[model samples]
Target: MSEPESVKDLVVVDLGVGMPSAIVAKFLREMGATVWRVAPPAGDPFESIYPAYTSWHSGSRMATPDHLDELLARADVCLIGGEDHPGLEWSFEGAALIAANPRLVVLQIAGYARGFEQRAAVDLLVQARVGLAFEIFSDRPVNFACPLPTYGAAIQGLLGVGAALVERERSGRGQLVETSLQQGAGMFLSCLWMSIEDTQSVNMRNPPKDVWAPIVRCADGQYVFFVPRYNGMDKVFAAFGIDKSIGDTAKKGYFGDIDLFQRYATKFTHEELLRACWAADVAAEKVLGPGECWDDEQVRVNGTIVTEVDGRRRVGTPLTMRAVQPNSGAPRTSLPSAPEDAAPLAGVRILDFGAMVAGAYGSKLLADLGADVIKVEPLAGDIMRTASYPNFVVSNQGKRSLHLDAKAPESMDVVRRLCATANAASHNFRVGSAGRIKLDPASLRGYRPDIVAVQCFSYGASGPRAMNAGLDPLMQAYCGQAVRAGGRDNAPLWYRNLYIDYATGAIGAIAMLFGIREQLCHGNAVEAETSLLEAGLFLMSELIQCADGSFSGGPPLDYDRTGFHCTECLYQTKDGWVAIAARSDDMAARLVNVLHLQGFPENSRSWGDSERQKIAERIRSRTTHELLQQLEAADVWCEKCNENGWQSLLDDPTARAANLIVETRDPNVGALITVGPLVSFSRSRLDANRPMSVPTGGVDTREILGELGYSSTEIDNLAARKVVA
Candidate 1:
């Protein structure tokens, strides 16, 4: 994957609203693609909804709608909000546009599942409908502060576009790509399905118990997210007069109780406690928003976390694509080609040694898209299995599992043999861990000289905190997401959504797809990388630097604390809750007129506590159905947050109609219901119905070795020697 200096040869037309479509265009623009936006000015990301994000992309512009045909003629990809935003001059029809440009890839982004699309494409509603609130906490659906589903949709969509481009190189024809907030939300919602298999475990996990409540309050009143999971943390806890109940390792392969120091934590100041935690190898960091983390030494030095894009500090691109250096006299191998009517990556093979959240999500996505991803694991099995069984199955499903211990030299030889049959590889090893096992990307080249390797981790590849252990919660605390919604003097509010963890996986997949494109188009092997920190920033791309040395965007929770602004916020109705995203004055006017709102101020800034209370009272008197009808009729975005979300999944009729929800029956696990691959292609299938292989645990060892030409006696000898589990 030769990542040449520029992607100036590619052109993209963004005709969508909000972050999902905008972020995709921004990435291509950052990579030198000619991006043109011809959207309704009010909702256009380039103009109003997120000027803070577009301001930095000076090269991107909002072209006139009349020029859609011209842009489509030469555009490699055209992103649209939905069927609603069709071209006024020509109907902006997907079929018509693709017909005009046979090579153009059209991507449609919506809020609901595919067949159920006309439901207002609002992020909050989608998050609510998917039972996000319940998934993280109680059994009832509740409202979420941020549009996390939107971010998840964007990254998945980004991968979709990239994969389409790679597939186009093979079939020489373009296709229609479809994705939605439901599909995006489903990525992290994988755990919901776990209840069907292991109800007890799902009942036990109550994710994200607070707005950093488990946080240690230092003497100075600053908050530190401390998870005392170090090897000798139990002794350190005793020394500090903290709780010593979590003796030895805190839950091996998972986090320990964070409240162990809650009672005694205030004895030390923030810095003092931080230093102590670091010295003791305990995971701890001061809680800060995305903007505050911008100045951290590790963040600034690595430059990707709060990167300077055109002199403005912004959450830059998540992917780092570099040209691979071929050996002195060898040529890169030609990339594999997908068979006609097959999935986008049909013939592509991946040796995935990745496990846990980020790695599992990314490679599992690759597995769904027809990549022969071999889930290579050590004999001890993936620790995620021990930490959360349901979580493990959701991420590990749809792929073949093999147990090959990387530590054993003989096992490593078998790993090398598998690598020779793979064109791509990935891992989430902590910094420097892979090299020791001879599984690093550079080391992989010795087996498949032209392999495209994707390596992911916390922090950066080479920073002071590079070797430090980190997780989803720490990322939220460090990069500001945890503080985005809570802290009503609560100090540090954490989100229940594992959005950053999920997005990191999608970004990793994006990097992998980009490398695949490089391999397919230019016959080049590449080294691509992404991180949780980078993915977290990308989710909050609204945060940006301004000329006055001040940053703008990523507003805190509103007065109601349910959304950012009054007009674009959540409200409780007679029967349920409804989310509204009528940000622009035009849409707000429609909302007021439709709801027969009286004494409503034109500016949300004018709505103080009393005014908000009055409006809330009025809305609370009306049924959700009445409000949805009146609001949507006037073009105002609104949706009744899903109240029966749990049961809804049992028979998601719309998802089934759209083929977004499918089933696979395993010999041992019976029938497994899942939120299948989000991206849908008109020309090819994504193999969403593929059954998950049981956790390998050496079940496939003999077959895998036999495929590599190992004799039965040789395999018996290897097993006898304990090389292959």
Candidate 2:
């Protein structure tokens, strides 16, 4: 009720005329900031519903208002998440706005691109900027077509904004922070770069490229993605119970050739091979299909998959930050939008009906920031509930749930009633005629005139695939991600798991925050939409740029293996193998100087791939401990590459320090390791493992009925009829 005394009370603004902005606004509010949004001028609003369609503006058509400079100066943080083509009016203006905001912190979430225009575009927004400009994309790798996590980028984008605001207080100046969806997507495909660089080749023609971490189908027809490290191969060889003679690197030239290792790996059944691989700490896991993650013990225990909707739970967000101990000398960060506790979206609520991974996760993130997220599920629950792999417990933590078959008449009635309640007045806002929840624009208008509504359908709520079912995999196919993933040649391969789902979730959350911001500051509905297709393309923007040769700060893709030297590739040892990431000349010298190794090879063409293998073979003759000690002593950022994404805190000290994973308790699933915060915030910290106290589907229905002043008998009748989950 009191005026906000901190930064959380300031209003958020959504410049683009769409849902992504709305999502961003919603999250900002929940993070304790008021939001203000800007829609397209009247009826001439932008037509595209998806961020994918909206983000590709390349040319000069992007708007550059006469008062743009003033607008940039007025805001603390300005985010540009759309296209950079010069042909579009908005693109040029967006870039110009970044330059104009001398004191403003700007974040450009774009992809890696090539060509002069693309490079110029990068320069305009990111290049040579005072602050950080991050690129997240999926380059050409064995599993390049997988969904990238742009949704998380949105979270990072907002986090960048918050960080900028905090920095502004101390420095009295603003800095630029830029990232691209393509860059984020690229992170999923980094192994390709690792391989290209590791093999001491300018191009991807290295021997390792000849080999693949393939998912071989067993006689039972089950598939498992496998990529064995050095030690894993020995066990894999032993697992098939065969004598492949790959154990020692001294006699043969097998150490450098990954493809050679695969020849032997393909001999066993998929299941048999996996057991062997696991026993040897090789990177091998069943290629989880959609919805399959829910059934995994890791998913259940980690609280990634969860129960929802009349007792049928599904996958939710994978990141959580717990509440900070009150008054621990760590002053709570304040937002100008709302008062201290009320500072960040203190009284905001979100209704999420997204069935797939991305949308579902996006809503979960808002909840993490303190929004009351009511996860609306279909009668059968979210499709993710029945997803084959079923890792819902890890992603779906800490949220209330409700179920309604929107297609059914009675269920639709319940939805309408709930929407009506959302439209109604609350203590914080002026008493409204309607409540907040609404299925239609008209209903939302009457409900909370100042509220933001986030509708996260797969391809968005309209157009060709408006009614068509959408998810990460299909979208990857549609957006050319699968095609580009194959690189200049080769066949496209989709990355295992719900890749696009996580990305879409994060983007959806950004849109919600933008919409909510628009509502609180200059009350109006702010709509933005993002799809897997758009997100995929957005994250890979640099790829487009690179293909066109318009990127900057680095040469266009070139291939040269000469002048290369190092002990950086995967080294095999008798006990186990460890990957070495020590790649600098100094580090290389340190590896030789500190380890005090023998048989260091001399430089020359004579020491090509074949010779390089000879040196590696000699090194592998030692133990992992010996090599690790040598690298550690040299102070290189060396880490044993756990090809599998299963490194525990104990195994990886850095992961522990970054708080990448945590132990969380789930109502139905119990305690398990869940992924930690993607980005950390000193204050306004949400629990990494917040308790999901709301019953799967009990609270939403009960709360709504009670608020509608429905009698207990009526509520019981509805429950009996199964109108609510």
Note the Cα lDDT for every prediction shown: 0.70, 0.42
Q: TM-score: which candidate is best? A: 1
Stretches off by above 4 angstroms in model 1 are 5-8, 39-46, 61-70, 82-91, 133-143, 198-213, 228-236, 243-260, 305-311, 328-339, 586-597, 604-608, 623-636
lDDT of 1 at 678: 76
Top model by lDDT, which number? 1
lDDT (tens digit, per residue) of candidate 1 on 1-725:
44443255678898766677777788888766788977674443234556465653456876997787888888899987732221222225666778888899988787776667456566776766676644443433434555667776777788788778878877888888878887777776666544344344322243533323346678888888765452446645753566555464354323444554665777888898888877766677888865888777777656774434456667767777776756666664554665678998887777778887788778888877877778888888787766655666667777777877688888777878898888788888998998999988888888877677898888877777778887777888888876776624546666655667778877877777777677656555678788888777777788887656687888677544566666656688898777776655667667767766777777654555565566667789899888888887787877667655646866867666675666666554556666677788878786645665445455777887898889999999987887777
Q: Candidate 2's error at 664, in angstroms?
A: 4.5
Candidate 2 lDDT, tens digit per residue, 204-302?
Answer: 221232333243555455555544342334654554454666445212332333444445545666677777766665555544323333344433443
Q: List clash counts for every candidate, in order.
A: 7, 169
What are the runs in model 2 whose C-alpha is more than 4 Å off?
1-75, 78-345, 408-417, 420-443, 457-468, 477-491, 546-619, 643-647, 650-665, 687-689, 693-695, 698-700
Model 2 is weakest, by summed lDDT over 10 consecutive residues, at 554-563
Per-model TM-score, in order, reads 0.90, 0.51
